[model samples]
Target: YFIIQTLAAAMILFASTLNAWQTGHWAITYPTCPLTTTIITTAIMMKLGAAPLHLWYPEIMQGATLNTALIISTWQKIAPMSMLYMMHKNLPTTLVLLTGLLSTLIGGWAGLNQTQTRKILAHSSIVHMGWLLIALAMDTALATLTLALYILMTTAMFTSLNTTSTKTITDMGTTWSASPTLLTLSMLTLTSLGGLPPMTGFTPKLLILNDLSMNHLLPLATLIALATLPSLFFYVRMAYMTTLTTPPTTTNTKYT
Candidate 1:
């Protein structure tokens, strides 16, 4: 990861230098600087953990503690995304759109096979990053809203996971004994993360889709909506384990 960061730094410098040489200045507001925009955007993509450049994000997240994972999913995103936000008017629309859609697919599809909580959330973060990218392309204000909702939902999730020491879907089963109320809330929060309706998490997706339709991005909107289902499935399964299942046990807190 350090090597990648080093390479990314080099890429940023090269892109900046190219932009300077072409325009006799270092400003990038000109958006059509060809290769310069591509390199810089790609570098930012690496930083944002947007797929297909996102493998390292999940790996690092899975190994870290829950607190660290929270930082990675929320705080770490701010700088790169800020850079992207600044340059959105100049970014290549096709490149941004394709990468954003791909991220949603990869995050949703790959997460379905996981039982580990961190990995699941890692993929969930990628999916949200996708939405953020798409929103970035459409409207920076919408992107900001998407990002804010993601941070709130993820913080809620990781706090719950950390509180109960749950590192896997199966671990969630045991946590209900520790604090059933917390576990139940965690279940709902997971659905919110999955962008289920009536939850705060659903708000960004709803607005983004509405914006997309308004702009005649019907095909893109449809694909993204379908991609959401797989992620929602895993979230629903987690909710099932935490809230729905009646684990076969015969122990009481007051065994007299």
Candidate 2:
């Protein structure tokens, strides 16, 4: 993991060096060389754990503590994604679209069989980043808004897990006994994270899809939507475990 992080950092530095060599400037706002721009975008994509370069994300998150995992899922994404957002206009549309689609597909598929809660959330984060990348290709403001909403939902989820000390789906199954209110809120949070209707998480996706359709990206939008099914399935499974399952008879206290 350390080696991977070091390599990613080296890529970022190499991209910056290219930027400096091409424009004789230290700023990333405007790059004169096309290769430099492409390198920066690719490096940023890798840093954000976009698909094809996201192999390290789940493993790292699974090994980290809950608080560290929370930081990796939320705060660590800001700089690279912000860089992507800043350079969206200059980036290659085809590359961004492909990356987004791959991320969505892989993110969803990867989480379907995972039992570790952090890995599940890590994959969820990748899926959200896919949506954000797609939105960024069309509208930066929309992408920023989507990222903000994701941060809120993810924070709510990690906080719930932290409070309950849940490390896996099995641990989550007994969470209702710890605190029914927390379990209920966590269930709602998971539902919202699944991007279901009437939840805050759905709003950004709806707007992004609407924008995509308006922009004649209906096919891409449809594919992204379909890729979310697996994620939604696991999210509902977790919620069911936390909220609907009856406590075992061997428990000391009943959850009423």
lDDT of 1: 0.89
TM-score of each: 0.94, 0.94
Against the correct fold, how does model 2 do in TM-score? 0.94
- TM-score, prediction 1: 0.94
Give per-residue CA lDDT, model 2, range 124-229, as digits (tens): 9889889889989989889989999999999999999999899999888888789878988999999999999999989998998999899998899899999989
- Candidate 2: the clashing residue pairs are none
Report lDDT (Cα) of residue 117, candidate 2: 96
Put down candidate 1 lDDT per residue, 113-142, tens digits, no spaces. 999999999999999999999999999999
Clashes of each: 0, 0
Off by over 4 Å in 1: 29-31, 246-256
lDDT at 3, model 2? 76
